[model samples]
Target: MALSCGIDFGTSNSSVAIVKDGTVGLVPVEGDHVTTPSAIFFQRPNNTVYFGREAVQMFFDRAGGRFMRSLKRVLGTPLMTQGTLVNTRHMQFGKIIAAFLQNLKTQTDVFAQHDVLNVVMGRPVHFVDNDAEADRRAQEELKAIAQSVGFRNVEFQFEPIAAAFAHEVNIQGEKLAIVADLGGGTSDFTVIRLSNRYLRKADRAADILASTGVRIGGNDFDKDLSLSIIMPEIGYRSTYGEKHLEVPLHTFHQLAEWSKVNFTYTPKVIMQTRQILHQSHDRKRYKRLLQVLEQETGHTLLGAAEQAKISLTGQAEHRAAFGFIEDDFFVNIQRREFDDAIQYEVDKITASATQCLNQASVRREDIDLVILTGGTTEVPLVQEEFRRMFPKAAIADENKLSSVGLGLAYDSQNKFGDGQP
Candidate 1:
């Protein structure tokens, strides 16, 4: 049997799927989860490398500068200064990404079974329009890395297009559909015409009305929650009694990273805050008790605040304790408050969707289906916004999220014909 694989190298999480026996399915990781954490950690003292969940778990333990996450957003950007080093403090962007992909490859089941793998990966459409040069360079680098890892051929597909193909299997007739992919690092939209089961077969099907993206997703919301709810309770300030509050800033960033990893529920971020305070006050033993109180109070306040937000998605109101350190530091956040926190992002998504509809010269009623992909779509506020924005169209199957990788895998096999020798 020939082996071909499709990979969704997403900003927040990554997954690989394979086509076998004419059926496309997800390739399970060593631990049985189809999705792998999109994290990379470079460890010192032993020169060890970590990827996926293991890397994410080790993030807080490692120095922030040494552990890298969300480099996918930096793709097609100058966010990484030229010649800048990653963990080990001496490698450039190219090397860092290569290492991450290489580690991802090793974690895949196909690599173990196939002598030569045919791989198809997904990229955002904005990567083409906004940063063509950087996008092209990144593609070349990815291809080189895949080839080096024993892949016979590698190709890239627009993420929304890949997602649309996944959706095409179930839906039929001459119809227009909207794909709203709200991933961890970015959100993308694609409006396409689907007739029969084929995509891009004729000039009409090949037409792309509008595609737009923004660098906002679940991580951004977590940051907003942390800033508005947690930091203040911890007595955190940019200036803390003469010394710059650099440690609290670092702690806040760390909590954002932590939020991305542990998305299932609000994590107990108190320990992380404690570690920060301990390190920050290491020089002054007399201030240790105060630092501990600040850390505890901050975590309690932030933890309750985040829980409330998470809860408000399912409940109208959620009550949480905010003042473990100071009795007066309690705060209550209603569903409306959480909604207000994310209103800016909600507006951006709606505007993008409206612009896309206008660019397509299609009325909201013309859209036959809407597919919601990405973790952010799980938020009730986002769902309600999309529903309000596109009331005429029925949302496409919620089951489409897992199928993106499957379609990409099938496409890989069809496009490359099993990586024949």
Candidate 2:
């Protein structure tokens, strides 16, 4: 029998799955987690680029314009601008995706079992009608990329539809499900109805009556956190000459971007900051003074900020320490304050949900289940907001994260039979 695979090329993370012996299993990448980070890093030293975790780690590796993380946003947009020089960074988006797909293919065992690989990829429904001409061109470009990556048969299904299919397989009922897929760069919601008899007999096809999306997710949250907490405490002067004493806010912003994912060790970060400050003062004798201040102020402040965000999810109040910079550098942030930080974005999400419901002519009570996906949904405020909106409906099982890829794998196995010889 032939082997088939399903790929979830998500904006934040990507995963591949295959079915064997009538069961779906996620394909592990390099003995690590099943999902790969959706990042790319260009290394000038070797004139090569890296993808996945390696790329994410090298995000701030002193390479000039060598990192691109959110290229998915421009999938359907034109790559060229009048009078602008184009480089490898300006290469077509589809080709970049194809490169990632190629890397993924090389990592998995899917190619050995089947002479012709059949792949089902998840795409957002919003792309289907994005300015007809541009949308068609984008779809064509994506399809061509798949073909280039060696997939003989490539199929695209709306992401929410795939999530619904995944949800339907696990729960046996005749009811409506709301899928909230909050990925890295975008969040989409879709309402779907499922019936076991309908699915088993292929008599009823699941319908996506309404769908909506916003180009906001976890990355936005990280940015907001950096702005509200880290920037102020760093003593990063924005209004000054371009000297050691006068660092640009933009430079700190770039540093914050790097610090978000890197700089796991607090002491290392403190020491690094102290070194920078000492250099700024132009006095080698003050190096120890800078180190003492950093240890007593800077590290504590940043660490507390991150911890507060994490604690606010489960606790009503959280205090972030900032003693590294000053004696009274502490900042007390209540859960409410954290929620307020993301209030506007949460409102947007709620509004999007309402619009989807209205478009489908379905009331909140009509939704039988709500499936929450992505990391942002883990936020307490987001969870509370969604729960209030869907109090009556059961939040679909939390396992929906990998459900789409699993369903695709199951569908592939059924379509192609077992992989056994």
Clashes per candidate (backbone, < 3 Å): 0, 8
- Top TM-score hit: 1
Model 1 score (lDDT):
0.63
**lDDT (C-alpha, whole model) for all candidates:** 0.63, 0.62
Model 2 steric clash pairs: 296-323, 296-324, 297-323, 297-324, 297-325, 298-324, 298-325, 301-322
Candidate 1's error at 205, in angstroms? 5.2
lDDT of 1 at 98: 73
Candidate 1, residue 10: Cα displacement in angstroms equals 1.0
lDDT, residue 105, model 2: 70
Residue 271, model 2: lDDT of 60
lDDT of 1 by residue, 1-421 (tens): 4467788877767777776655567777537788776777667655478787787567544333345566676565664345344433555666667777776566564434644367898776654345668868666766776777666678877676667777777766766888888876677788987654564342333556777666677666666665665444444443332454554454444444432221212234445544445555343321332443333222233335446656777887666653344455455656776777788877887787787788778888888888888767877899998898788888875643455576577567667654333
Candidate 2 weakest ten by summed lDDT: 80-89
Per-residue lDDT over 340-420 for candidate 2, one digit per residue giving the tens place of the 0 to 100 score? 777887888778788889988999989999988766687888888899999999886565456667656655655566555
Candidate 1 Cα misplacement greater than 4 A, ranges: 59-66, 79-89, 109-112, 127-141, 199-207, 235-312, 316-333, 418-421
Provide the lDDT at 9 for model 1. Answer: 79
